[model samples]
Target chain A: MTDDLPPLLLGRLNHVGIACPSIDDTIAMYARLFGATVSTPPFDLPAQGVRVAFIDVANSQLELIEPLGPDSPIHGFLKKNPAGGQHHVCFEVADIIAARDAMRARGATVLGSGEPRIGAHGVPIIFVHPRDTGGVLIELMATPDHY
Target chain B: MTDDLPPLLLGRLNHVGIACPSIDDTIAMYARLFGATVSTPPFDLPAQGVRVAFIDVANSQLELIEPLGPDSPIHGFLKKNPAGGQHHVCFEVADIIAARDAMRARGATVLGSGEPRIGAHGVPIIFVHPRDTGGVLIELMATPDHY
Candidate 1:
């Protein structure tokens, strides 16, 4: 099926999502160890059931996500890992809908409602199932407003 | 303890390592699904006990690693996952020794013999323990030649 279609317009990695029990501790580690500047006061995403912050790196950002509550999506992961771990890796795409359609055409499974929803970045985003992505939950998000 | 020490010089992400049972299947999926152009032919890193390949993305690379044998370090990961999963995430550093020392000073545990070893990229590299890295095994490698 390798035909004349253009390659996926995946932009630079926006951020890597790390699920942690305490965003404060993680932020402290980055600050003390790497001198990373973190976005102030994590904001809660009730729809996503997580609180998120960003640690600005040289070229990209590291997203720290903490479960908002027991029913949070990342709560199960934190329960199993306790200390938490890499949750998902996000990449930027020029057009999220086109990316989703391309993935769907190739039989890739989009998670959740299988439609693009406004993500934490306030851009359209869709998650590809881990099974279809070699066990890594992959999130494709439209390029951020500033980018 | 944020004292009078220099911060770690972590460069842009070099790649995200994915441990896969079959690089061929993974490559095919990326090609068909994302039209990703993968580097041709997998290469063996005997010392690392894994076969590796790279899929170049717009800004970074996706490293695909497969166990070379039962003794392969990734063998255990594949056994647990059966399919495959994200194994590690690697970032480039300006200096290996400086980064190592900074991490050590900050109480981060360095894996292996506690010294940098030649990694798959033929550059000095060290793995930081997941315990100290928010449950994510982090690889710090000297910036590759020409990169």
Candidate 2:
């Protein structure tokens, strides 16, 4: 927004995160309905406290994540929604640190520890507070295979 | 899910729909944060009872829709959510009817008259009941232009 700083190197929408109650059921539903391809099989990411899978779409992908343990954000979301729905939208950025700093300068809050963490896809990412982004949690992922 | 039917012609993820209270504010937020470009200008689609705009992304787009009239679906969404959030994920399909029929045969409910309606993007689109799609409102958009 400001002329002083350069634009953030934003790439494509990498994937849309869908909070799923059962990755198995979700995979079955999409596969049966749309013949969706599963690029990533279901596996537990203990660090993120979620079991995750990726549904390959033509352009981007859909990430299905279920809470693995208590106190996980996905668990909190499912408890609030119960029906499971879109959780967050992850967009690729060329430089993670630059995007983070630029967003902060523009008054956006980076969630968690404000440091890049290994995301569900094994790429470094940071979550921008939903409060700052029209009440939608947005994850900025570093592309071209992270630093 | 049935193998008798040929696979539905699913295309790329076309756009993700985001309900907005004010298109102006939404555009401003994305621009200031990520230098996001506006692909489609704000325009009122009275037929759909909504005001719509498209934000450009590398691979796809974000459709920002606000309630134009009181009974608009976006109006109901805003009322239910209040803070606004991701409303639906739209995927491009080569053939709309075949896709709809495939879903119906598989026990998925197609919203409205079970016919493709002109969507916010002026393309033929239909909504599959969230109940059938893992609680996420899914929009199947006809691509390569429509009939």
lDDT of 2 by residue, B31-129 (tens): 878888687889999878889999878988889988898778787788777778999999998888988888898899999999899987677889999
lDDT of each: 0.83, 0.85
Docking class of 1: medium
Q: So what's the TM-score on candidate 1?
A: 0.93
lDDT for A15 (candidate 2): 93
Clashes by residue pair, model 2: none
Estimate the overall C-alpha local distance difference test score of candidate 2.
Answer: 0.85
After superposition, the stretches of candidate 1 with alpha carbons farther than 4 Å from their true spots are A4-6, B1-6
lDDT of 1 by residue, B1-147 (tens): 357535656788888898899988888777776777676458988888889888877677889999996799998888777778778888999899989988898899998788898987789999989898788888999998764
Q: Could you tell me which 10 consecutive residues in candidate 2 chain B have the lowest summed lDDT?
A: B1-10
* Root-mean-square deviation of every model: 2.0, 2.5
CAPRI band for model 2: medium
